[model samples]
Target: MEEELISKKELLELKGISYGTLYRWKRKQLIPDEWFIKRSVPSGQETFFPRDLILERVDSILNSKEETSLDDLAKVLYGSPVEMNITLNELVERKMISDAARSAAEPFITGPTDYYGALTVFSIGREIDSGDISLDDAGTMIRSMAAAEDREMLRQGVTRLYRKQGVTFCAIISDASKVSMDVSSKLVLEISMPRAAAAFKAKLLPNKGEEEDE
Candidate 1:
């Protein structure tokens, strides 16, 4: 199915952001160039964006711009392998991961968690929080994600949960577009790592109008 799109004019008005701000974000690489889909309109050429993706991205930017520079925000949104170690407490305090995820992941966690480790826990936590996956199934998912040799793949790959014959399984694939599942298995959930990373980073940044305690 073709993606639902919103025109540039509509986006600007709906989001209450000026064209200059939008273009500035584009120049800073915070908003990807490819997302600007130009098409022929009756009035002339017009630009558009994937509706849901652009809306969420703009909200993330607006929420984080106060606490983070556009460059740092770009790095968090588009850069690969964010090099940072975060303690479990820090993750919770920063609102990067939910309490449900923390509870489900604490036993498996050893010490300071890296980006992928935190993402794995956060992803599983989301499933558990949503009541989609049981805590027992989360263990399997966590182990599978952790066992991946190329940890970087988990950074931008797709994570899927499947159930077959009363057993749960997890798989990570780089291209979500080409996913093919077994006929007998029931697909439970699929999380886009890139989107998850964006949301995570947005959460990591201090909320707008909120000051950090010294």
Candidate 2:
């Protein structure tokens, strides 16, 4: 990767804060101090950083400023020199507006679905209810996913979850779905378990008759 550096002047312009405040923040160690290397410049010496590093440092301020004191903001945003989840909760507990209006002191958290990453498959099984004629028509099909091919099939399966039929809710318990080998690339056993159904199902059944798949 390439380095991202910014001169002291550049940082000031980007921050739009006065030199006095900058020096004050420096004294407080809100940013890199010793790391702020000085280099030769036309006007003698100038402090700078690789632009990316500067941006990274700025991002360290997980908690943004609003009306709170700088100390409070840093403490809430960056936690202590030692981090604990509770420290981040302080700003929010005080109801300081760091993000939006209502989300003033909230944590900036995201989830797995919030990001796109490699998905993991635990186990593959079908939901076997004495209903759904399709179950009897085809003994069971199985497709195991441990590679890119499996993920793609999973995507298709998840997409069809709302519209398709292979992964249907079973009447066995409060929460369970019927699954089959028809939509998997895994073991070809039509065993139904508690519903935490897979995203999609692929048809590779041994039945001689062609059954239109979802």
Best-matching candidate per lDDT: 1
- Give TM-scores for every candidate, taking all chains together and pairing residue i with residue i: 0.80, 0.33
* The candidate that achieves the highest TM-score relative to the unseen native structure: 1
Query: Model 1, poorest ten-residue lDDT window?
Result: 205-214
lDDT by residue (tens digit), candidate 1, 1-214: 5899999999999989998999999999888777899999999999999898899889988977787889877877767556667777777887666787777777778689788898888777777878888888887888888788888778778888899999889899998789778899998888878767766665555543343343
Name the weakest run of 10 consecutive residues (lDDT summed) in model 2. 199-208
Q: Give the lDDT of residue 108 in candidate 2.
A: 21
Error of 2 at 99 (Å): 26
What Cα-based lDDT does every candidate model obtain? 0.81, 0.34
- Per-residue lDDT of 165 in model 2: 46
